[model samples]
Target: MDWNSFWEGSKDLSTFALAIRAIILYIALIIATRLMGHRQVGILSGHNYLVAAGIVSLAAIRMLNPESSLTSGIVIVFVYAFVNIFLSYLDIKWPKTIDRKPTILMKDGIIHRKNMLDCHVTIDNLLGQLRLKGAHNLSEIDTIVLEPYGKISVIKKPEALPLTRKQMNLPPKMVALPTILIYDGKIDEKNLHAIGLDHEWLMTKLREKGIANPKDIFLAMLESDGTVYISI
Candidate 1:
């Protein structure tokens, strides 16, 4: 057993070279993911999953095979990202053709046996999922839809649903999004500008909070109601 050859491949690329290659590919993948957008990470379709798998395979090949060129691997990663972006555009453009609609597996407290069979879901599996969703029996469920990603979405019967503010005749409250002002000690200028805030305003707020520098704060979030939350 050659320890040296085992630790470092017999090829021209050394262990250190492989480590650097892995790091470069890792950064490239991150950039590619950013280019593909948040949807690629949030809700991945079957084709999107395939694209991710293919990019991973390419990166692995580059790191493992000394004969593999970094340029070729990086090109493949970019190509996969671009192709996924294009496919995503097409999916949005023609959802009916590219994507499958959610199947109604249950309706009106009764299981749609044909849909269950078509989706390859058994009664036991359906019962297990129903239990996981806190439905004691089928009678409590008004509808159950099997999503394209193989997840179950359950809608409870009108009587079984939770009471809302509207039911109590309560006034609706204003809801606002929290904007990230500072993350990892860096100011998000675009977000700050979007909220009609400038650098001077941030500085004044930071100073009021006894924060001498933006780098001193780990995270700072501005709420919709003009409240700033700072964490060091």
Candidate 2:
């Protein structure tokens, strides 16, 4: 068996064979990803990210290019996936073994310049993340922690805390999270059931609001305060 010719089989395989090979590799890739349990793309840790990249590369190579040992390619993909899963388990049990400790970028309104430098977080990045957390002035912050995932958690100073109803001795009103009843002209039956509303009742309410059909509304949300908002 010529080692070079082994990988050169892609040129000789017919389109029908290529199609079958593509299907098998595609299924193998999907299964491997499912086993890894890493759903959100591009937000993975360094190890998991590498595993994902490797699996994709393997699938692409065997599916489009030379169909190397199809069985071996699939086994390699699953092996990488299992290794990733094991790493995640280890991280859960032994934390810093897989995840770096979160660094404090700011404390008591003072930015930790040295820690920021060590963590490779720039002054501009600090300010940007702060702005995203609704904080503009460093002096108004209590502590800002930078997570391993490149996200920041901001804590405002006690003095800068917003005044709530409790602070003013005002009566606290019950709050209910608004649920989407319809989105993009499609009714969410599950959400409607969770909200204790039926289809007939929704249709009746829509008609009362001069909407004959729920599909005519672009978005419809039900608030806890018995308010049904319809966006056309």
Candidate 3:
């Protein structure tokens, strides 16, 4: 294979220079995300998500357009992050300044039609979200809360809840979580060590399952019952 030509790009800049630029921008983006706060990273609230979207768009522009100023991109990122933090501080100090309290969509199995209308939520939408939460009908619900993040939170009535084993005086059995031994053809040595197992034991188990190498197995999980489950 002609590896050099495969990796070759426009003659505008040397590959070494491109690599350096990529590394710097990568680190800068990480710092920018960290400054944006942990909550805003993966699980963003309503307004925070908008800020995150804008930052992502700006970062993309800076990455694709080589003529764009890197310093300007970094400045915009930090500015957005700090502005979001400042607004959050104000929200805490004056709760009503930015965030609205959760809206009640239903009360005691009765749909609050006016409240739902105010929130622009349809009955079908409410029913779909309710079904997602395992509620078959409105009679089984006590309260339906519309969270600010555009998700519905349902509270089932205590009387309508399904019976549990404890209510019938059943004994509890020991439950142990399954540990991942291998994932995506790579053995997770740290997890194996944590579960008091080693490479030799894993290899033996794999051999027993007709897998000569750990890489041949797609996934391997150690169950609580001392069984190694292999998936290829």
Off by over 4 Å in 2: 1-9, 38-44, 67-69, 171-193, 198-200, 215-219, 223-226
Q: Each model's TM-score, in the order given? A: 0.68, 0.77, 0.73
What are the clashing pairs of model 3? Answer: none
Q: On lDDT, who's better, 1 or 2?
A: 1
Highest TM-score model number: 2
Each candidate's root-mean-square deviation in Å? 6.2, 4.1, 6.2
Query: How do the residues 90-186 of candidate 2 rate in per-residue lDDT, one tens digit apiece?
Result: 8789878886888998877788889989998898888998898889988788999998778899999889989999999999988999999999989
The TM-score that candidate 3 achieves is: 0.73
Which digits, one per residue and each the tens of the lDDT, describe model 1 over residues 46-100?
Answer: 7788887898788888777866677767888999999999989988999878877
The TM-score obtained by model 2 is: 0.77
Pairs in clash, predicted candidate 1: none
Scored by lDDT, model 1 comes in at 0.85
For model 2, what is the alpha-carbon lDDT of residue 203? 94
Rank by TM-score, descending? 2, 3, 1
> Which consecutive 10 residues in model 2 have the weakest lDDT in total?
1-10
lDDT comparison, 2 vs 3, better candidate: 2
User: Candidate 3: how large is its RMSD?
Assistant: 6.2
